[model samples]
Target chain A: MITTSIESVPGRKIVEQYGIVQGSTVRAKNVGVDCVAGCQNTFGGELKGYSQLLEESRAEALDRMIQQAEQKGANAVINVRFGTSTITQGASEILAYGTAVLVQ
Target chain B: MENLIGLIFTVGLIVVAYFVGKTIENRHFEALKAREREFLDLPSLTTQHSYDEEGIQDCRLVYGNVVISGDYFKMVLAALLKFFGGRIVGYESLIDRARREAILRMQAEARQFGADAVINTRFEMSKLDAMTQNQGTGMFEILVYGTAIKVNHG
Candidate 1:
């Protein structure tokens, strides 16, 4: 499936609109990684553990959104946007939303 | 004697952190500049869409994410500056490096996909360690995403 953040695909025409499709995931870092990150903060630089964790979470959220688009019988998802918010002390939520459309 | 020892220790830690953090920051900025120049040909724009879609061959989504933390020395320096209500140069450079690195990564991805340009680029920044905003790590995450398009020349 084609997924882009613009209103229309470059070479495809939107034949039908399937409204909005969304996916979200709540993720928390494990205690072990969190502890390591806490220590790394002292030295200060890139937090590799946290970056990897967030990347995985984002991929999962995007996958879920793509699944939703497939279920809706849409061949493409456009105008995609991501949202993130801290839910608690250790957990955060990532959301992917976009308009599903049939392209030809 | 105990108070004097504690003062010495705190100062020692800050001094060590200052040297180490500055070295890392300088190295990172150099690397970012080099990679940015490498991807200079691939333009990324904030417009909603490309103006010339007729010559485009394919389009897809691309993104880059990074998380960076301020060193102990900068955290302390920023806290001190908070009292004077002035700019925190340390954290400013930290965020600047993060943003440039993120865009470079995005451009690299577009290059891998054989995309000529990226459109509708957006950035999102958030605090990763929200629980300890003041006392703990000054950490933040930067995410940049856009639609990459392959343009047909012939």
Candidate 2:
């Protein structure tokens, strides 16, 4: 399936509208990673552990959204957006939402 | 005696953090500049859609994100500046670095996917401070995403 952040795919025409589809996931890293991130924080640099965790969670959220679009019989998802929120010291929530539509 | 020891420890921590943080920030900025030069020709735009539909062969979503934290010295400096109600240069640079790094990563992903350009790019920046409550280590997460498109050469 085609996915884009723009309102419409570049060369495709929207033939059907399936409304909005969304997916969200709350994820956390292990204590070991969190400990390393805490040390990195004190030194003021990239928190590589946290960055990886967030990226994995975001991909999972996107996959879920794609599955939803597939269930809706849509060929593409457009105007995608992402939202993030920290839930606790080691966990975060990532949400992906977009409009699902059929294209030709 | 106890108060003197505590004061020395605090001062020493700030001194070390200041120098170390400066070095890291400088190195990061240099790296960003070098990588940006490498992707100078790959356009990353905020436009909602690809302008030339006929020239594009395929497209897919690509994204990059990063989590960065302020050093102890920056937190201390920002705290002091908060009292005076003026600009906080420390935090400003932190955000700037995170923003550029995120974009660079996105562009790198597009390159890996063999895409000519990225369109409809969007940025998301948020504070991860709640997770580090009372630690005074300001944390931020920056995410950038876009549609990477492969253009027809012929």
Candidate 3:
């Protein structure tokens, strides 16, 4: 399949549209990691743990967005954008969206 | 005297252990990044065909999914841990990376087919299910598919 970004992929023809194709997962922390993280802050150089966390979430959200487009029989997605929100203090949600289209 | 000595030793031990563990984790993360870079750097293979004499070409390409399952699991765990503290994880990077890689592959395929643009792209994901009694393993699939077209530059 061909995939194109909203800005890079040209043409206005949309063959199919999928309404809010979304995928989400919720997570909770283990006490062990937290206790350790708290201690590391004093001498911290980099928060590698948190960096890895965000990377994973972003991939999951994008995977869901692509799944949605495929289900709609779309050849490509255009004008893709992402949004994130905190469900609580440490918990967050990532969302990806785009317009499903077919170019003639 | 003994209590003071023990407390200091315990704190020192915890601090040391924390750094060691973090270093190991960081090393693994770096390895993952390297793998991702290698995957993206591989040349994209494309195929194209033309329909009608108007110089319009139709193209299709396949892209392999980079399933970072280990990283994903870690991030989820981290987010859960942070929930109590009210800090959220930034997930945009992962999504953006996946999208970018997929698009690049598509474009490469279009170019291979001698097409100027790609049209009608679709993505899909499949998860594997295992039957406990039968001992059958299932496979998860993620796919990005699209058509490429060549048009007049003017």
Candidate 4:
């Protein structure tokens, strides 16, 4: 599926707009990462574990957005956006939303 | 004796962190530079929505997201600089790394579609690990998305 942030897609014409489709997930830090991160904070540098967690969570959210678009019979999702929020001290939510459209 | 031992342990850990973190950062930067050079031909942009709106042939939405964690040393430096109330170069590098990396990733995705350029590119950056308000323990995530388009080469 082709998607773009611009209102219009290049080459193909947007035949129909399916409004907005979205997906979101809330993730908590793993215990192992928490323990290691707490200790690593004293030495400060890249925490690989947390980076991995964030990446996975983000991909999950994006996947859901695509799935919703698919269900809506959209060939593409445009103007995709990612949002984040700290729901609690231990968990954070990742949200991906976009416009679904059928392109021809 | 116990206090001395604790001091040694703390210092040793920070020193280890300094070297380890520096190595990782340097390596990531090196990779970023090399890839950026490879993408010199594909120009990504923020304006000029349709790639030749008149003769546009095909377009697709492509995106990339990256999350990078600040090293302990940078965090510690930021904490120290907080008292001086000045620019924190240490944290700046963290932001720069995430930003550049995210853009590079988006470019890579464009390349997959054989796109000559990406249009209307946008970025979203946030702290993924900002559990503690005043603490230096936080992770930065940068998400970049754009439309990859190929226009006829006239």
Over B2-62, each residue of candidate 1 has an lDDT whose tens digit, in order, gives: 9999999989988988998888888988888888888878999999654588888888999
**TM-score versus the correct structure, for each prediction:** 0.95, 0.95, 0.38, 0.83
True contacts kept of each: 0.71, 0.80, 0.01, 0.55
Poorest 10 consecutive residues by lDDT, candidate 1 chain A: A34-43
Candidate 3 positional error at B3, Å? 16
Reference-based lDDT, residue B88, model 1? 88
CAPRI classification of candidate 1: medium
Can you write out model 2's per-residue Cα lDDT over A5-89, one digit (the tens) per residue?
8888887789999999999999866788778877787779899988898899899999999999999999899989999887887
Give the alpha carbon lDDT tens digit for every residue of B90-124 in model 2: 98898999999999999989999899999988889
**Interface RMSD, candidate 4?**
3.4
Candidate 3 wrong stretches, greater than 4 Å: A1-5, A8-20, B1-154
DockQ of each: 0.68, 0.71, 0.04, 0.48
Span of ten consecutive residues with least summed lDDT in model 3 chain A: A39-48
Checking candidate 1 for backbone clashes, the offending pairs are none
DockQ of the two-chain complex in candidate 2: 0.71
Across residues B1-154, which tens digit of lDDT does each residue of candidate 3 receive? 9999998886675566456644644564565566556445333323222223255433333333422212323344456767786433322333434445445554555566676555445565433112011111111223455555556555
Backbone collision count in every prediction?
A: 0, 0, 26, 11
List the candidate numbers ranked by DockQ, top first: 2, 1, 4, 3
